[model samples]
Target: MTNAADARQTKPDWSAVRLHVVTGKGGTGKTTVAGALALALAAGGERPGARRVLLVEVEGRQGLAQLFEAAPLPYEERRVAVTPDGGEVWALAIDAEQALLEYLDMFYKLGPAARVLRRFGAIDFATTIAPGIRDVLLTGKTCEVVRRRAESGQGPGHGHDRVFDYDAVVMDAPPTGRITRFLNVNSEVSGLARVGPIRNQADAVMRVLTSAQTAVHFVTLLEEMPVQETLDGFADLRAAGLPAGGVIVNQARPIVLPEDRLKKAAQPGGLDQAELEAGLAPVGLADPEVVTALAALAAEHAQRVLLEAEQREALAATEAPMYELPLLGDGVDRVGLDLLARELRRQGAA
Candidate 1:
């Protein structure tokens, strides 16, 4: 068995982090990354070292369920997937309306009157006239989950079922464009409630948000706009005093050709067709049309490689730990998620 020194050396980069908030430009695979992170965190351990983590989706898109190929999830947490180490990854899709009802019940004992409020357009009124309350309710519920303790008095990673304890919580948050405002709920609701439960809840959420226990990671592709947005999002996090996590570059394509050929094909005038035809001569596939097609493909690959290198340089300025996930040839599935989780573990993102 490994000793204590090896265990300490193997600790993850985010070992102190309990709340992981993932956001990205749309199509950057934010939800996918969040799910993979949960899997990575929960597994990667032997019997007594296993962990249980919760993956929450707050956008009401039910996209988390779709990512896992499960049916639509209610507001309640349920076991969506079990990790290789027998740990659990529970999922919850938080709905604004349901969260509002729960908030009412928690503070005011609304009982059946909560539904009455919903029936008479109170939900709409709160959402429209006092939109900030919506944010307060949603974030408050998430904080509640993050702070919950186990009923059995067993902390996480103890080889027993943790009824309410989770080692970490991963949220698939909004797109980068709105993530700042979405997370800074205290400012959003300051005018709505200065000293009431709403303000208190908002304050509590912010406390967790600005603490070392929380980290907001940005997912991005190696494209211009996504990379720029990732940079901007990191700046926003710094301004908000929220903890920023890693920059996870997703759907990264590999550079297949050798350096010499890649440089030759990356020229502005495109590839040398006659030279490419000779390269294909051994296969009896050196026709002019085939040569032209091959040259075009090579040119595209070269351009992509060169652009990706430029973006990588841009991402370097962020100074955050970087993690890259490969583009799955067959698209993302359970197996794809497993592969990504392994990569995350190998990269110390777990």
Candidate 2:
């Protein structure tokens, strides 16, 4: 019991954070990182309980479904997998058209008007070309679920079976290039929607977005462009009055060389050719040519080691909690994703 108390005390205190918005440069594997984060948060507690988290995708790309190895998800929520601590993860791909219809039903109780709107090009035009409306709908739906209030003080699986009563909601948001614009719905709709239900919806979403309950995490690679994008994204979130979460460095490679060897290799002509040749002599390759080649290989590895160190330093300068996901030799399959989830939990990203 003493040990249990200590462990509980040391656990990451993210209970107040209910919404996690993940975005990064394209091809940074932000989707995979978001899925793993959801799993980590769902099972973050040591004791198994009925905690549940929702994973959402808004681009209609079916990326979340692909990561979970499930069929494409409809707008409706469905159980995707169980976390290590027996928590549940529900996935939803928020189709713009469906979200619009749902919004109408919720606001106007438009039973037939929704079908009529779909019959015309209104749905397509609004979701495709109506600037900022699409963003409002996407963000509004996510925030609505995040801020859902259970009726009659009932829990999940109780009186009303509140489906949206999740402990947290992790969104596989748009890439860094569009994330700020996507999330800043209030600004986007301020010009177009001044005083209507649309404006009201945007305002409601902004309240949740700017609150401490929400955090937008950026995923990056240990490279120049992605790191720059992560920094820019962080700045944009701050400017938009949104809370910035930790920095997640994905597909990070470990430094294979020892500290002493790395230091020696960094110096000019510091490697001893004779020592390399002697080490290779046991394998019947005492040739000077072989030694030179080995030395070149070491130098190349040393350069990478130095570069990785510089990248990590830049990331650390952000002053946000930094978490790293290792590059799996085998590609990110189901088992690999689970391994990543465990790593995230260990690093306290949950």
lDDT of each: 0.84, 0.83
Model 1's alpha-carbon lDDT is 0.84
**Candidate 2 vs. true structure, TM-score:** 0.90
Model 1, 124-153: lDDT tens digits are 788878878877777777888888977664
User: What is the per-residue lDDT of model 2 for residues 273-328, given as tens digits with 9 covering 90 to 100?
Assistant: 89888888999988988888878888888877788778878876677777888898
Pairs of colliding residues, candidate 2:
none
Per-candidate TM-score against the hidden true structure: 0.91, 0.90
lDDT leader? 1
| Poorest stretch of ten by lDDT in candidate 1 | 1-10
The global Cα lDDT (0 to 1) of model 2 is 0.83
